[model samples]
Target: MATLSYAAKDSRTMVRRNLKKALRYPSLTLTVVIMPIMMLLLFNYAFGTALGSGIGPSAAGGGEYIDYLAPGIILMAATSGALTTAISVCVDKTEGIVDRFRTMPISRASFLTGHVVGSVIQTMTSITLVIAVALLVGFRPDATPVEWLAAIGLLALLTLALTWLSAGIGLVAKNVETASNIPMPLTFLPFIGSAIVPPESMPAGLRWFAEYQPFTPIIETLRGLWLGTGIGSSAAIGLAWCVALTVVGYLWARRTFKAGAKR
Candidate 1:
């Protein structure tokens, strides 16, 4: 019980420290917030006439496409937040902070927990900001209040999973540059999924991969929740992916942290 209490307290402290860093360096958080909105506007305006037509008539123009596009961009914001976690973790490891902590009597999980919790909170905020901006730009979801809560729940789960995955990537990275590069694929996932264009319009090969990848199911589930199409198996698959990734990420990250303990 004492050990558990120590772990909990340490984790909480780390969470506050990370949040303080985020507040101290507002630019990084600002960048995470702005990137998705920029993507939302750019895609909605610059390509909405051309690409929006492909999604459906409602998506063709007059900002109707923003409705279709909002969920995916919100997911993209989560990806951006994950990248921040990766970079921050890598910096600490590379700068000797992780090593110093290893030499201390700190709770083993606390260091990583701080980062994961902080990133989750930050990502959630970024998602909210993006959604609000999307609303301002005429994005609308027909989901009811309950459905909206459900969608937020899904987003929160995704944020937690991605942050942990990013933490693992950062921990295993050889350097800060490598850490930054490792999580790049996550941000690029929006392009390959149903975000920019529907998967049905893609080539058979690309379509197969897109439909099977973790991001597509998540995006599809989000779309279903927002548009009232029913999440169906997409929600199951998305949740499975989130659970699997969270488990794998936590395992590997815990191993990595304990490996440092042995050093």
Candidate 2:
């Protein structure tokens, strides 16, 4: 009982440390917030007319398209923000910070816990900013208060999964550049998924991959919650994926960290 309490307390301390570092630096967090907003603007203004036409006549221009695009762009914000976790973790590993921590009596779990929790908080903040910009640009969700809560909860789960995966990547990466680059695919996976266009619009091979990829179901689930589209099996599948990713990431990160500590 006491051990669990102490671990929790230590994790909170680490979370605060990471959050303070983010506030002091701010550049990475700013990039996380800005990229999604820029993408939202570009797609809504430059291509909204052309692309929205395909979705529906009403969707043409920035009108209905923003509604469709906002969820995906918001998810992208989460993905982009998750990258910071890997970079920060790699920085700590490279700078001998972890080695220093090893000498302390703190809980080993707290280090990774801190990074993942802190990244999730930052990612969600970025998502909130993206959603705000989306609303400003005419992205209207048809969700009730309950649906809004569910959607936010789902987004938080997705962010948690991605942050854990990023933590594992950070532990394994040989350098900060590699750590940063490894998670790049995650940010753009939505482009290939139902995030931007229906998989039915793609060629057979590409569409197959797009539909099966983890992000597609997630985006579909979010779209359903926010826009009242058919969720079908996406909510269940997305939840499964989040759980699976969290388990995989947590195990991998713990194993890698343990291996390093032994050395």
Candidate 3:
């Protein structure tokens, strides 16, 4: 019980520290807020009509594609948030902060929890901002209350998975710059998947990868929730991916951090 209490207090302290750091660097939060909104507007206006022909019409009924595109954009916001976590972790390690913390009696997991929890909170806020903008720009969905809750759940799950993965990447990176770049592939994954254009149009090699990769199933499930499209096994597959990534990332991050402390 005492150990549990210490863990809780440490997690909260780290979470507060991370949040305060973000507040100090207001641009971080601003970027988190603006990037997703900009992406939503850019894609919805510049490419919505063109892409709608390929991705399918909105289930809210019309050829308009913003509805179909909004979910993917929201998820993309989570990706952006994950990048911030990687950068923060990398910065901490590069500055010898992690080594300093190792000398203290605080829980080791506190550092990871603080970044992950704070990042997830910030990412969800960004996602909320994107959703509001998407609605203003004519995105619509026929989801019920339960479906909306489920959608939020899925986003949380995805965010947690990606956050842990980013945390791992951050810990393993040799420098802040390298850590920032490590998660770049995740940011680009949506593009190759069913995010903007359909995978069907890609050449065979890229098409096969996009079709079979993890992002497609996750996107497909999000698309299904928002637009009343077919989910099929995408929901199950997405959940499995989230679980697998979270487990792998958590293990990797803990191991890496412990190993780094030894060095």
- Winning model by TM-score: 2
lDDT tens digits by residue: candidate 1, 1-263: 99999999999999999999999989878988899999999998898777767677543233367777888898999888888999899889989999888779889789999999999999999999999998898877777888888889988988888888899889888898898888888987978988888788899999988888898888878888787655679999999998988898888888887786676
Q: For residues 1-263, could you state the per-residue lDDT of candidate 2 as single tens digits? A: 99999999999999999999999999988987999999999999999877777887332223488787888898898889878999999999999999999899999999999999999998998899899999999988888999999989988998998998999999899999999999999999889987776788799999999999998898888888888887899999999998999888889899999999998
* TM-score, candidate number 1: 0.95
TM-score sort, best first:
2, 1, 3
Compare the candidates by lDDT and give the number of the best one.
2
Better by TM-score, candidate 3 or 2:
2
**For model 1, which pairs clash?**
none
Candidate 2 colliding pairs: none
Q: Estimate candidate 2's alpha-carbon lDDT, on a 0 to 1 scale.
A: 0.89
TM-score of 2: 0.97
TM-scores for the candidates: 0.95, 0.97, 0.95
Error of 2 at 177 (Å): 0.7
Q: All candidates' lDDT scores? A: 0.86, 0.89, 0.85
